[model samples]
Target chain A: MADEKIKSPKIQATEQMKQLITEYYIDAKTTKLPEGSHKPICWITSGGPVEFLIAADVIPIYPENHGAMCGAARIAPGLAEVAEKMGFSRDLCSYARADIGGALTESGAIPGGLPKPDFLLCCNNICGTVVKWYEELARIFDVPMFLFDTPFIHVEKPEHATEYVRQQCLELVKFLEERTGSGFSLERFAEVAMLSVEAVDLWKGVLATAESRPSPFTCFDAFIHMAPIVTLRGTQKVVDYYKLLKKEMEDRVAQGVGAVHDEKYRLIWDNIPIWYEMRNLGNLFAENRACLVADTYTTAWAVDIRIEDPLTSMADAYTKVYLNISIDIMLEQLVELMERYEADGLVMHSNRSCKPYSLGQYDLSRAVAERTGKPSLIIEADMTDSRVYSEAQTRERVEAFIESL
Target chain B: MPVAGVDIGSLTAKAVVLQGREVLSTSLTQTGHNSRVAGRRALDMALDRMGLDEGSLGFIVATGYGRTAADFAGERITEITCHARGANRTHPEARTVIDLGGQDSKAIAIDERGKVLDFVMNDKCSAGTGRFLEVMASALEVELDDLGSLSLESTSPASISSVCTVFAESEVVSRVAEGAPKVDIIAGIHQAIASRIYAMAARIPTNEALIITGGVARNIGVVRALEQKFDTRIVVPEMPQHMGALGAAIIAGEHHE
Candidate 1:
């Protein structure tokens, strides 16, 4: 297996990205609060308006990303079991279970477990689970929580909905000011929002490079590379990091270096990645000479944010993200992804953690296949929970899907 | 060239040897504790039946859940594709294949060339599979093979509403304790399994030439129940259990080319 990995080279960017994330996490954890100009830590949802936190000079931490780390480390089930033991339903979102468990047990992939949150930011743009999940956290930590209620976009985002979210953004800034004793800075906010947009555009450019025949990188690479973009979105480090990563991808494309050795087929992935099975899943496709060129999960960050009008644009962008929208729009997006990536098939992970992403995937699978004249495979598993995964069954389905293609 | 296909399923291992387009020999055996041993035993039995040795075989392909566990095969294909290929081989017009194995059930949609177009499988449930039938047979104190013919004798099929196998088993036991006829309860169990299978199969368009191929296909009651629910005449190939191995053999022959 070690030799196999050496033979199949991983993206050169992953090593650097890991160091960057490590440094970022260390800085967030070690930074002192209320002393020597230290920033407070704000536990934010994955799809929350983190730029506001960044603009307010508050260190933002994502429980979802931490849950994914625990998943990759194969400790999610232990954490989830902790939550289940506390009377939470096993059917509840695994990420929430893991997060709640990590908080309670004070055990996680990280050493100290997500730098004790000074406050909580709950956003429902990604899923409704976060609202309740964060409320529970607020109760446990006894901190002032800010909830950004982004209305679901069934078909279209109404102007009032945008105004509603925009006003909430303003309120969030005021909340941050009152809690941290730091006034909002428009100049710093604009700079952070611009950097965030630049990082997102760079991420988009990196993903688009996969449109080349024998894609330069796979979705697994994007899944890992997406870390800095998610956690440090509004920081200059994210922009610099993505610039360096984008250059590597461009070079690989120019050199005709595909992520898969032979690249016999190109496929698109749907829903959150099965975090525990990332390497196994990557190898499964790579072994079949089928490269997963793109996925709907990581591309959520690529939704171009308008820095000129950051408030309203952030509201619209976050509201219309891939998960918060209707099945019609989701299917359309899947169809477009298939065509754009020139995928031979689409592999949809019927993820158990993320219902907003997993629900309606079967219907979307058929719709995309009909549109692309290709095939689609739906594998049932949770994003973070490894116990729900049946390796033998999933292997059979994946191999069969590739064989059919 | 004599090519072989091996299907190492959860309960049984099957093998088929093909010389060109003609099936030279076939073998079936209990999978037992080790899939690798079962696979080797099945293949060796087929070879011995053909008055040949392993050296005579040109290529081999493995299918079923234990396909990866077997180290002997040159390639491993999925049972979904194998079933489709085997069904299409036996019945030239077969476009759909429903395979009911010990622990799982699947409905596969295939093209004219025997390539799988779409498929759906039961989600880690034994509610609508051969294992479910075996459990019901034991609960009714009936032989697995005889349960099907016995169910045909019932005039009124009892209602078994529980979709879960465990609950359905308890339902069957309770009905028996209540002095309900075994044949009616058996019929209901068959119908319950068929309903779940039909629901999963309905996910994709079940085009013409729907064929049922698996160990459970031998159970006439479940087959008839499924036929009744699908509202279509289902064809069961001769030696349905060997279809996956046969398909693997066919694929092996192609790979040898």
Candidate 2:
């Protein structure tokens, strides 16, 4: 049944993107081996500052990304159960549980699990769960951990808050220098920051291509193609990848091709993609002629970093992320995305795993509807955990939402 | 020409036959295990009542949870759209339609022309649905139909804190063990369902001229409880469970025309 419903047209770049992600994971897993680049492995959060590690010639590994891989492989439930049996609440972030379970059991989609981290770096900008999730990793691996605290932006990004994060960036530099027993050159950091900014710009351009009518690619494509921007940021490869992707999308748009056949409704998605059900959902929307053109999750990594003062700008950009901001600000951004994409409606994933992303979604949905007069549908499911997901319920709501539109 | 609509829900199947705007006949039956068979049976029963056969129907539309299983249906529409169309046909002034069915519940907002503007449904949980009341009825050893009348006798409704069906059933048992009146406990169960529905419905812009439909609408206790919660009069149509089927039949007639 799902096979027939999942016949959404695919983008040509998907094959290249899959190869890129596979190579990225293989490199991370083999970093410490004799045949691999003998670089130190540092486990970092998805929203953590990776340019610093990249500049220092350290391999930055994202357990959150690995959790997503586990989810996509349909092994997250078994991995999460290991943690659940160990007294971790089922309500904890599935990413954290899956990662911990993968680490403990040494079993996941990837062979030998993720390489042991020499150090752990976590940022609370994404969610508070990472603070404890990384701490647990630190305890399990007996490694040094750094918690780069970014204060929640309630109304505005205050100067002191930016300064606070700026000071931590400096501390992070020193921490890397002392931990690696090497001098952290400002010139090298600036170069990596430049590449990071360039990649972000290209990624933003890639996403903005969907602004064209009958968008060439849906957010499902973005969710899969966003690997490099999240994992390989501050590198020439990410910039090159986005250039290729952006051109493909532009060519598709010029050829009058749409992600969904005979696109009837365009929608903006909120929160994270349901990692496990991406194909099912993508196909479901395509079958309905509804294209999820824009989303807030992948767009979170498209930050604007100024090269004039790399440290200060990076601090400000990282401090003011999509998930770290207030609901009112989120509404404004969502409304902007809706207008930019000419969306007919909104779909919000009320993820049970990530509180920061899912909380206040109801209010945000209401505000978006009031501001843009567009209806929003909130589907409850975890980002990685499929146990909480009800396929029948989700299908009913999604079909009903599309019907209403 | 006559058109027919079949609604194969999780627990029951309903069918309605319509000629122009007037309802010719309606039938209800247990869905049992096979939705496809149940859907055919329902439509056949309604056709029997009207002294007609499948060949006489101009069009057939299927709806409800098991709409997809009805391969015999010429068209399949979701219950949300069907309920909105059904309620709007019955009460043209109604803008809000609340449907509490066997295993799920939904609150739909429709335009004056019976087009769905927005809707919200209870999540995978069965707390605010007819199944919850059925479980509570079995736990309290009372007939499901008599629950509404018995609850009306309660001077003070007992408090059911847990909204989960399993937990609430245990709460009902404990209340009974403590010698609390069954009427009060039943009233409390209705209030719990009302509150759950209210929280979900409040997410949308619920307007006045509200109509309640589905099997649970027969329970006056829940209807009155919802009326008090929304602080508005809720019109329960004569054949609440048949609304989805009737709406499908109306849509079928329109399609045929």
Candidate 3:
């Protein structure tokens, strides 16, 4: 530390972001209501990872989902700047920066800023970052962090990995039991799983509504609407909220209330939302009546694959998502979303923030576009950093491609 | 009689207020916080530079990601339409246009008069886009203005493989650790950027006078690197960043009865 001139990028938003996150912490901490046991909370990776958590009398909060929202809100830039100011390289994903920055800044201060986690769980099937992120979080909070180590079995649904994940879910129950002084009940767990499954089924129906010719709702809306699910997924309140959303979407479809007016060409989107750009892009699509019928990111919450339902069913599904698997699974999901949405084209954002999501997307674009006789538009941009967006270039490409489609 | 164009790009908003064939004013400004505010401010600056106001214009067309958001705009044209229009106006023989903007990159193959034929765009990553260039340029402590020139000083350019911006930051750290020449690494960054653009250009047999537009056109190093990659001198229009907006304005002019 002897006069080392740090060659870090100039992070202009660092102090302000730290202040904002600290504010969120203060807001979340100062207002504490009477603790309710049934309102038990758990945070996990995806819509699936929380199933066991939900089934175990715990409300599920998806930190990764929240992380994406922070990126989308364009707040991640400031947080990343803060992280950089702390000597972390700009090389880490902004999500990691924002999360760590916000947590460090809060130090027990905002409404839900680093909420005291009763328990944390992950399938670790998605990214190597999950383990490190959770481990670090667990270390800081002194909370129980359960890791479901699923083997990297590309396609084969091997039993060992499933068993490993299942054991982790049991461990999660034990971990929760230690805090609440309650034992695991198999019957109660199954009931909770069925309820979780039912909630997801309704969510899938809502997503399916996008397939309508006019597209009742855009993926942008879905991204916001999915917030309740992430914050309260295991709760009956979440299930009730989605039921209402699904019915409204149904009514829209029946009455022909399209999210986009004069729906002409429907398209499917692959990869993450341009977080800071969903509104502009959504409006652009609406201008042309080209509904973004489905998105890979939003659709994940609605994934209801036919997996065996027992103690381990939810665990396996949670860990076996496209984020955790190879490109083949992603490609398959693309095709499925395309066909289900009845899209005339596909728009793939080759996002710079996440490589695993963007990997081989070109091939997926080509294959899906040519094989299905649907055109594809691939636009490149960062998820959070506005510096990465070329508004003119993107508009040009999107307009040209969409006009053709 | 004069026609003007404005390209309200993500990184910077540029205004090219042309009085007939004579260029009256060209203004460039950072998009800062709000694109709407930036677009309006850029137009006002350009108009002020020309000793005119918004009402003095025959018509106005807005283009770019912020085009639809332009309230003063009488009409909105897609960046594709504007880029080609701007390029064709600058170089009549131009058949292809590549616009590397702040967040994304695109290649448009156009006809003689600036109608798009086949096009490819990369919208997913920051690798080849302005953000990537800015990040790498910052790491090298080379001003955006000097990156292109610095690369020229390189004897042998190194390679950058990470398409993700975050990954590339680490990659740059490794390059520095290996003691690679800063100039060559800078040159390699330009090449990494060029390769991403070239992939889009290769989607079809791009026509001659391959005009490069958008904010990236300001990067002389990227322009030079692209020229080398394609084995041809790439065409860059005067006030290249404003091409999209100018194309929009031109379209607006044409649409006026």
Estimate, for each residue in A111-199, the C-alpha lDDT of model 1 and write its tens digit: 96878898999989898889899999998889989999989888788899999988998898889999888689989999999999999
Across A1-405, the per-residue lDDT of candidate 3 in tens digits comes to 111121112223234334433443344344344773344555566534565555555645556555666767667777667768978766555566677776666521123465556667765666666777777667766777777776665887778878887787677777777755667777776665666667778888888887777777777777767665544454565566667778878888798877666678888877778878877787667666577788888766664534346566666677676687767777787887788777888888887767777878877877786568776787878777566677656766777787555
The sequence of per-residue lDDT tens digits that candidate 2 reaches over residues A69-164 is 889988999999999999999999999999999999887888989888999999999999999899999999999999999999999999999999
How do these models rank on TM-score, best leading? 1, 2, 3
TM-scores of the models, in the order given: 0.97, 0.97, 0.69
Residue-wise C-alpha lDDT for candidate 2, range B167-206, written one tens digit per residue:
9999999999999999999999999999999999998889
Regions of candidate 3 where Cα sits further than 4 Å from its true position: A1-41, A68-82, A107-112, A170-180, A305-308, A373-375, A378-405, B1-73, B85-95, B99-106, B111-228, B232-257
Question: Which runs in model 1 stand beyond 4 Å of their true positions?
Answer: A1-7, A33-38
Off by over 4 Å in 2: A1-6, A33-37
Give model 1's DockQ, 2 decimals.
0.80
DockQ sort, best first = 1, 2, 3
Query: Chain B alone: TM-score in each candidate?
Result: 0.98, 0.99, 0.93
DockQ of 2: 0.75
Per-residue CA lDDT of candidate 3, range B1-257, in tens? 44456667778887777655556777888988787888889889988877888877887777777776778777766787788888888888988888888877878878887887667767556678888888887887778778878888988998887677888878888999999999989888888888777876786558557888887888888999899888888988877787877676667667553
TM-score of model 3 vs. true structure: 0.69
User: Residue B225 in candidate 1 has what lDDT?
Assistant: 97
